[model samples]
Target: MAKRIVLFMFMTFTSLVLSGCLVAESKYLKKAEEADALGREAATLQEMHRELSAENGTLKAQLSRVKEEAAVLAKEKEKLSADNRELDQVLRSKTDSLSQTVADLRQKVSDLEDENARLKEEIAAAQKAREENVRQVSKTYEDLLDSMKGEIAQGQVTISELKGKLTVNMVDAILFDSGEAEVKQGGMDVLAKMVDILKGVQDKMIRIEGHTDNVRIIGNLARRFPTNWELSAARAINVARYLQSRGIDPAVLAAVANSEYRPVATNDTGEGRAKNRRIEIVLVPRDAP
Candidate 1:
């Protein structure tokens, strides 16, 4: 019985020890399973974090591109605004210049009108002076004609009064020898008195005219003179020169010869021939006093 009890105790101790070892092995297995599950979960979380980080980097690049585009648009808008302002300034300057030009044109037109009025006044004054000059010239000629008429009526010389002009006839019998251009002493005295009368009239033009009969000159006198026309011309020129020497303006004297061309009476009679050979003096009114 003592041997059996000892064997029984040894088996019991073996069984208890085996039981504790088995429990410990089970606990270790459970802990290993929990650790494996936790490790798988951690690996999944790491993959998800890597993917999120890559997505965030892509979104940040897109935002940067959008901000660059916005900045370019803002610069373009500023440039357009500056161009519009310059155009507006140019338009305003052109409008002001046009207004000033229009005002200057109006002033020039007004000045031209004033100048035209002054020219009109000057022309009117000149016309008035011309009219007054004509009136004075007419009165002076009429007075001289009347005085000459009175002298002719007193039997000193023969004269005829005509419309707007006068005529004087100096007969050759009273003034010159037959077929001669020389004037007698008495004829010279008469001519001198007429010269004095003509000198009193200022600014008068005087004409001395000589005439001849149809009778021809003969001998050396004919060769020297050629014709009665030449003799008559010489006589008229001599009378004109005498008048010029007697203080008459040379501009006022004219000489002409009419050789038996113009006659007041027929050349058939001796008395008519004598009347044809004569000298005449005419006075004309001048434009200036």
Candidate 2:
């Protein structure tokens, strides 16, 4: 359009110049310059519009990609929420189990404490009973020792107390004849004194242990007592029977024989043989079974 306007103006100026109607050259040149300037401005406006349209297309593409990335991020967030919920359920289950286990451990600890207390009480009771038993045995030992001081001084008897057991040793000559198992009058009197001292004994067993010297049975005596074992056994039994008859508790009585064994002295000499042929009265704890 600007070119057409410039062409029409040029023709009009030529017609005027040919008819002798002259126009100013400055005005005509100024109109041509103004037309060229308008054309240049129009071209610049169209180029700017094209560049703007391309930039708008690029911005639209970028917006579409940004929206797609936002959708993917939303899906990931939903999946993460589901996974977190599952983890929470598992954690709660484990926590509940741990709580119950801790409670059971606490209960077991309380039960053990109760059991420990019960054991302590039982041990205390047992200790008290043991102390009472010791006192009872000590009194019995002192009383027997005082009452038999004369026999103890003459070496006819020896009294000993060891590890809660009390023992009284008497020679065979004081309790029996040369080859007899019978208790004589003097022996009965000595046993009567022992029975009096031992009457108040509690929770104890009184055992009569008879020992014989290392002498073989021979002559007429061999017929009835074939060996020292038989003779010693018979003598122990007789002494136990006599003590039972003298107000001692028969339930606490036991008889044992040591024939030429468990001797306190050797049987080679006459004095040692006399010491070996002795009876022992022992106070001991009762067997359970």
Winning candidate number (TM-score): 2
Per-candidate RMSD vs. true structure? 12.5, 8.2
lDDT by residue (tens digit), candidate 1, 50-119: 9988988898898898889889988888898888888888888988988898899889889888988988
The best candidate in terms of lDDT: 2
Give the per-residue lDDT digits (tens) of candidate 2, residues 43-70.
Answer: 9999999999999999999999999999
RMSD in angstroms, candidate 2?
8.2
lDDT (0-100) at residue 238 of candidate 2? 97
lDDT of 2: 0.90
Candidate 2 to truth, TM: 0.68
TM-score against truth, every candidate: 0.47, 0.68
Off by more than 4 A, model 2: 1-13, 16-101
